[model samples]
Target: MPKGYEMLPNGIIRIKSDNSMYDPWEIKKSQLDGEELTLIGRVVWAEQKM
Candidate 1:
């Protein structure tokens, strides 16, 4: 399966690492207002082998 991180519709970020999942909702909340948010990250695609 492809692994990394993603920002959910609920304003929650799912971080996948070491076969574990972490939800950083609190941090996302603090960084955003309402449904609008600016996410900063480098998205690496597993299929591309980057």
Candidate 2:
């Protein structure tokens, strides 16, 4: 993560469990390389709150 990098539109980020855990909302920037494009996690359905 850097200071002024923008997140890719419709782009999903997957970080390894070995990496540090962070809230998705807290990720304002990222430093992704082409080799690190592999997905480390999958997103399922989100629960609806009433």
Candidate 3:
């Protein structure tokens, strides 16, 4: 699950951690602009690769 993903009215996804939106876009719960996006089974790292 995304760190700051929240379900808004009418089913939109809002990523609070994304300080680039500047305005509220298609922020919904469990949905990414009516599309289901996931990072499951994906490898992640806290530090950048050097």
Best by lDDT: 1
lDDT of each: 0.50, 0.38, 0.49
Q: If scored against the real structure, what TM-score would every candidate get?
A: 0.29, 0.18, 0.33
- Residue-level error in angstroms, candidate 3, position 45: 11
What is the model-wide C-alpha lDDT for candidate 2? 0.38
- Judging by lDDT, tell me the better candidate of 2 and 3: 3
For candidate 1, the per-residue lDDT at 14 reads: 60
Candidate 3, poorest ten consecutive residues by summed lDDT: 38-47
Q: Which stretches of candidate 3 lie above 4 Å from their native place?
A: 18-35, 39-50
Among these predictions, the greatest TM-score belongs to: 3
Clashing pairs in 2: none
Query: lDDT of model 2 at residue 14?
Result: 29
Give the CA lDDT, 0 to 100, for residue 30 in model 3: 53
Preferred candidate (TM-score higher): 1 or 3: 3
lDDT of 3 at 6: 68
lDDT of 2 at 8: 51
lDDT of 3 by residue, 1-50 (tens): 12355666775665543335345345345533456665333235455779
Residues 1-50 of candidate 2: C-alpha lDDT, one tens digit per residue: 21122345556442334324543332312444444443344544456789
Between candidates 2 and 3, the one scoring higher on TM-score is 3
